[model samples]
Target: MKLRIAILGTRGIPNNYGGFEHISEYVSEGLVKKGHSVAVYNSHNHSYTASNWNGVDIVHCYDPEYLLGAAGQFAYDFNCIMDARKRKFDVVLIMGYTSSSIWGMLYPKNSAIITNMDGLEWKRSKYSKPVQRFLKYAEKLAVKYSGSYISDSRVIKTYLKDKYAIDSRYIPYGADLFTDFEREQFDQSALLKEDYFLLMARMEPENNIETILEGFSSSTSHKKFKVLGDTGNRFGKFITHKFKKDDRIQFKGPIFDNAAVRSLQNNSYLYFHGHSVGGTNPSLLEAMASEALIAAHDNPFNKSVLNADAFYFNNAAEVRHLVENVQRHDTEKTMVQNNLQKIQYQFNWEKVINEYEEFILECHKKNIHEKVIPGNR
Candidate 1:
């Protein structure tokens, strides 16, 4: 049966930035290809109208500062949920549960709510105490009220099950969109001459940018480190200045285009992923797709995503040890290449979409059965 679906939260279908937005675009396009009617709510800040973008409907949510930063994201997400509730969509797939919990609770009867609680947002070190408390409350409400919840990592799924007694479906983010660009496209010689290690993240405290830079700079090995992505908060600027004079560290700031990021990922010999919070980082997955030798922080989230394949580090000592040891193994490069090949096949969008289609259909059938049972009604 053809289903009418609307993906709510983040910026809509074109997916100009970030992980959830990318998921929205891919899943919506995938559903449309399967003959399902799909609509996506776009933030009004981007100059797109109510037109079909790649065979799916685009509904705009009005907000002037929608593209600003984290604050803008919260506002845009809230508006998206409000707009989604007004639409007659059969299934509403909300990206983040904390921001949309109120709307999910008030959703009309019989509407199947599938909230993708992307990660443990309430546990992030970036948010203030009050905000974190509010998010925790909101997350609880979202899990308790939704018909179903989706988790991107086993760690997060376990958290949800333990906290709310909700067994969320594990639907991890796929890395199929990442491309292994030709090495000739990037200035590999220049990157190598700079003697820089690469790190890409949102420049938040929880991402542990400071610790990574500190470890890299203090290391006896003389290698520069280039940090990408925006310092979205005041703390980022403070940390940047603290490590500014270290000739071994360079902050490249944020690069907007996806292709450019792919080029960076492809050419880098090593990728440093220090995210201490969140689950299944899109950037890390993309780096893995590019076959970069990963040196990730020791966390359950990273372990689950990498399947314990990448080098894990808990402190500066471990980071230094991995940096020194990585070059000793001549077969490491081949192993990384093989891992990328495996990841490409395992994390393809077609397979992910197929699973989504089946799950949605099953949920719909179950909802129909509930409606038919007289006593249950």
Candidate 2:
């Protein structure tokens, strides 16, 4: 049956950046091809105005600068969901339940609400006490009201089950094959000239950027270290300045182009994933797909994503040891490649999108059946 679907959260369709935004674009396109009428709620800051975006409708949301971090995201997403309700969509998919739960709870019952509860946001050290409490409550309400819940990692699904008593469906992020141009497009000339290690991530405290920089700096090896992403905050600026004189460490700010990033990912000898929070990071998955020798933080979510194929480090010493010893193991590189192949095969966008299609169809059918059965007949 043809269904009108609306995707909420992360500024919609042409996805300039952010993982959730990319997922929304991909899934919306896929559903459109499958004959479903799709509409994505766009943020006011986006370049595109409310119009038809590749056969799908775009609904614009006003963006206010007063709110910051998760709070800002919540404000925008809450507005998107409220707008979706007025459209009378057959399915409304909301991403990140932290602030959007209030609107999800109010969405019409006939509109199948699918909430993508992105990996444990409340556990992050960044939020204030009241914000954390609000998120926790919002999470519970999201689970209670959502017709279906989606999680990207098994770890997240388990957390939802244990914490909210909600069984969430798992659909991991997908990967694209890197072409020759894509593999060589980024400005990696400096990196290629020296023996360099690569680290790419947002300069957030939870990502352990400081620890990685400190660990690499303390190492005796003359190898260069390239860190990607912006250093906008005080902590990030402090670290960048502290390591300014250190020729071995280079901090390259965020690169927007996918092909440019793919070049960096493919050329790097090793990829350092220092994220200490969240489940199934897209950067880590992208690196794995590129078959770079992976050195990741030792956490349940990291281990689960890498499937024990990559080396795990818990401290600076361990990171240093890996830098010194990583070159000695040729077999390890092959293993990384094998694991990358496995992940690529299993986590393709086509497969993930198809699974989502099935899930939504199942929910629609169930909803129809429930409505048909009269209690007082």
Candidate 3:
């Protein structure tokens, strides 16, 4: 069935933002190519000002987020929902609930509403207790309002089933296989292949950025440690100031160039993934696709994706030990190869798009059937 879909809950695509936007970009384009009509809601302040991207329609909503800080997200989400009410979309896919679930009641009732229940936001260490409580309420509201739900990790799917009795669909994030350049050195800096370490993520408490940095700083290795993300935020500033004394650590800021990012991941001797609260992180998938030797924080979300193919670390000491001890042995090569195979067979973009299309079609058909039968409710 050719479905008309509208995607919301991101800063909007050509992906200058994080995971939600990244997936939205690929999913929208992919759906359009499959004879489906898709529209992505972009923020007015987004860099790309176009009305269309590829064959998908782009609806720009007024976003005061730049001026209002955190409060701006509510306004942006409100605008998107209000605009969606006027569209003819058969499926309205809300990507996350952190800033948008409060308006769940205002969502287009005619469309089959599907919420992508992102990682347990209330568990993030970055949020205060009061904020966490509010996020819990928001999650409940999202479940109450959406016609269907999607969980990116199996852990989250199980949690939703256990906590709310909601059987959410499990759809993990996808990544592209890194084949741009074979042995292409990261030309952004003077760093050589297999000589430096890498960590790319937003600077946040839940991400265990401080823990990773502390471990790297204490390690005896002479390799340069590169941290890539915008370090202008409060936590980022704190991390930069705290690690300034360590000359080996370098803050590279945000790098959006796909080739450069993949090259850096491909060339790094060890790539550290410190995310502890998310469900199937996009960066982790990209690292796996790049064949990067991963050292992830020991957590269910990361473990579900990496399994035994990646080295796990719990504390700063473990990080330091891994940093000092891990070498390019035959096992390491085997692990990297295994991760690449997972990317090709399981987490590739084609599989993700196909799964999404099938899921959306299924939800739409159920909604239509329910409306006709009424007793099917």
Best by TM-score: 3
* Model 1 misplacement above 4 A: 47-50, 64-78, 177-190, 193-195, 374-377
Which run of 10 residues does model 2 get worst, by summed lDDT? 186-195
- Model 1 Cα lDDT, one tens digit per residue, 248-269: 7777888866666666766565
Q: Which segments of candidate 3 are over 4 A away from where they belong?
A: 180-189
Tell me the lDDT of candidate 3: 0.93
Go through the candidates in order and give the clash count of each. Answer: 0, 0, 0
Per-prediction RMSD in angstroms?
Answer: 2.7, 2.5, 1.4
Determine the C-alpha RMSD for candidate 2 after optimal superposition of all C-alphas.
Answer: 2.5
Considering lDDT, which of the candidate structures 2 and 3 is the better prediction for this target? 3
Highest lDDT against the true fold, candidate: 3
TM-score of each model, in listed order? 0.90, 0.92, 0.98
**All candidates in order of TM-score, best leading:** 3, 2, 1
Q: Model 2 segments beyond 4 Å from truth? A: 66-72, 184-194, 374-377
